[model samples]
Target: MIEIDELLQQEAWRFWDQSLSGKSKSALESFAADDLLCHLVGQGQSPATVRTWVHDQTVVLGIQDHRLPFVDDAQDFLRTQGFTPIVRNSGGLAVVLDAGVLNISIVLSELVQPIDISAGYEVMLEFVRLLLPEAEGKIEAYEIVGSYCPGSYDLSIDGKKFAGISQRRLRKGIAVQIYLCIDGSGSERAELIRQFYDIGVQGEDTKFTYPDIKPEVMASINELLGTSFTIQDIVIRIQQLLQHLTPKVISQSITEDEVALYQFYMQRVLDRNKKMLEK
Candidate 1:
């Protein structure tokens, strides 16, 4: 396990917006930025970065989701609900993204030592633990069986899930990502995925067993914590946490080089998603 003490020793950079509104960066752009930064960090050109992002009314689907029997219907249903459907390159099933949801990505380089899957997940878990100190023993990592994007690293309180963690590795760099449901109703979000899978699969018998989603199994952080924590509040908490961990936590901005690299990664993801959706 990589300890927090060891993580603090590395160079850290923070890239986040203090306000939650008007974030125009698409989900694809955010993923590309992570990949670009990963390569930069792997080459020792940039420090480890903690980035926060949010997208409005989008449902990010996994590759398996594109394989659904009635995927076209699912995408149409999502569109009818005023949500844009996007096929993500990373791992995970369908997940909702909106202003109420905040995503955090911890991009690190494994130049010195390799980061195993468990260790990569632990890093994100530890950061979440630090951010929500109030939920000390309540925050547990286990698969919420009925929730959308159910995974072994699902961050939940009691039996209701509020966040899910996923990782993407490239060029000796890793991005441990988590989407925290800060406000709004998590069950409502789950209901969206439930409806999506319900329509997408149409009860067809396939090799993949789509989750029989129970919206009640999901809750937002504010609901679980019994406090009104906004997207900005958590973002500030994360910034403070990173600043406390390192002496020189700087705010990072996109560079021309990163922009060029981002174009490459973005096109790759776009092409992959295009191919998957076309199937």
Candidate 2:
């Protein structure tokens, strides 16, 4: 596993906090933003970046999710539950994203040899561990069976998962993304996905096995740590952690050039999503 310091020892870091951008930003734009950052960072046009985002009532689905026999109906179910559904251009199954869920992405350049897939995951896992020092040994990275988007790098305490990490690579840059269940009921979020799969699969066999989604095996950090930490609190913690790790933490949004690039990426994502859902 790569140490936290090793991954964050850059001379400076760029930080983007878009958690309160309101509903207009949408989760699709967030993924496109990460792709833009990945390209810039990979080409050495930008420093390593840490971005935080939150979208109201959004459910990000994996590519495999679109292949479900009744995916359109499953999406309709999510809409009835007040959730906007979009297929993310990354790995992992469907995951809920609300104001209570804090999403973070660490964009790094693979300038040398390609970064090991596990190494990308370890970077986010170690960063989360650093963010919540109080959790200490309680935080473990392993596949939490029955959890939504369950993966080998699922961040959990005692057995219930609170976060899952996924990676998106572009132009030799890697965007390691994680959604931390900062506040609210993680089980409730899992239950939402549980229903999605139930309606999606309807007892039919799938080439890719979706999680059984035992809601009890999932929890928010607040619930697991017995603390009342909010999204803003965790955002502050991320800033402070970055400050301590690097000499300078630059706060900025994408540049004008990046805005153009972001538009191109956004259109690509929009097109892909429309195609997937329309199928």
Candidate 3:
């Protein structure tokens, strides 16, 4: 687990993307920011940053996800369904991203203490618990079979997964990220991926085992709790939690250095994505 007591006491910055208009912002930009933030923190030029981002009608596929036997058919299906499919330069299965799904990335410097994979996951788990106090003891972090993007650190309530955590490290800095399905139906989201796999795999035996997705195994927080929770409500909760955690939560924008680096990383991501699609 992350040394929470140690982490909260440190100076931190926050970046909340005001992309309520949805399609105005690019999901690839978020990936680039994670790369840039990691470098800045690793170099001691910036403090840890917590960034909130959201993308609409996008399905981010892992490298493994792109390896599906009939991947072209999967891509075509997604496109026809009005979903922009992009291959993420990270490790994870297919995950749905949209305006209702809030993504939080905790970018931390590893200068003082090395953050192992498990510790990184735990930090995000702790943050989720902080955001939803009502879910304190009920939320469990474990793989939920039949859920899209199932993993050991899948965050669930009862038996339905509402979130999943992943990490990326660069230059001694670590970015632990989680996607919270705060609003929309999580089962509906899972069904989309299930269809993608059904079209992509066509019963072919792949070395990597694609999930036998069962949409019933996933649901949004609102659905799980039988309450109407909006993304804005959760954003406000995040701000409150950050204010309580730090002496001052400095709102930041992209610096010149970060902007330049973002352009570089964005190009790399695009190139890799194009290569994957071409394959």
Best by lDDT: 2
Whole-structure CA lDDT of model 3: 0.85
Residues 1-279 of candidate 3 have per-residue lDDT tens digits of 457657655666665554464445668778887888888887787888888888898999999999999998998999999899888867899999987898888888888787788878878888899889878799999999999988999999999999999999999888999999999899899999999999999989999999999999999999988878788888788878888888778777787766787788778877877787777
lDDT of 1 by residue, 59-145 (tens): 999988988999999999999999999898656899999989999888888888777888888888988998899999889999999
How well does candidate 2 match the true structure in TM-score terms? Answer: 0.96
lDDT by residue for model 2 over 230-251, one digit each (tens)? 8999999999999998989999
Instruction: Give me the runs in candidate 2 sitting further than 4 Å from their true place.
Output: 1-4
Clash count for each candidate, listed in order shown: 0, 0, 0
What's the alpha carbon RMSD for model 3? 1.6
Name the weakest run of 10 consecutive residues (lDDT summed) in model 1.
14-23
By TM-score, who's the top model here? 2
> How do the predictions measure up, each by TM-score?
0.95, 0.96, 0.95
Q: Which segments of candidate 3 are over 4 A away from where they belong? A: 18-22
Between candidates 2 and 3, the one scoring higher on TM-score is 2
Poorly placed runs, candidate 1 (over 4 Å): 1-4, 16-22
Error of 1 at 176 (Å): 0.3
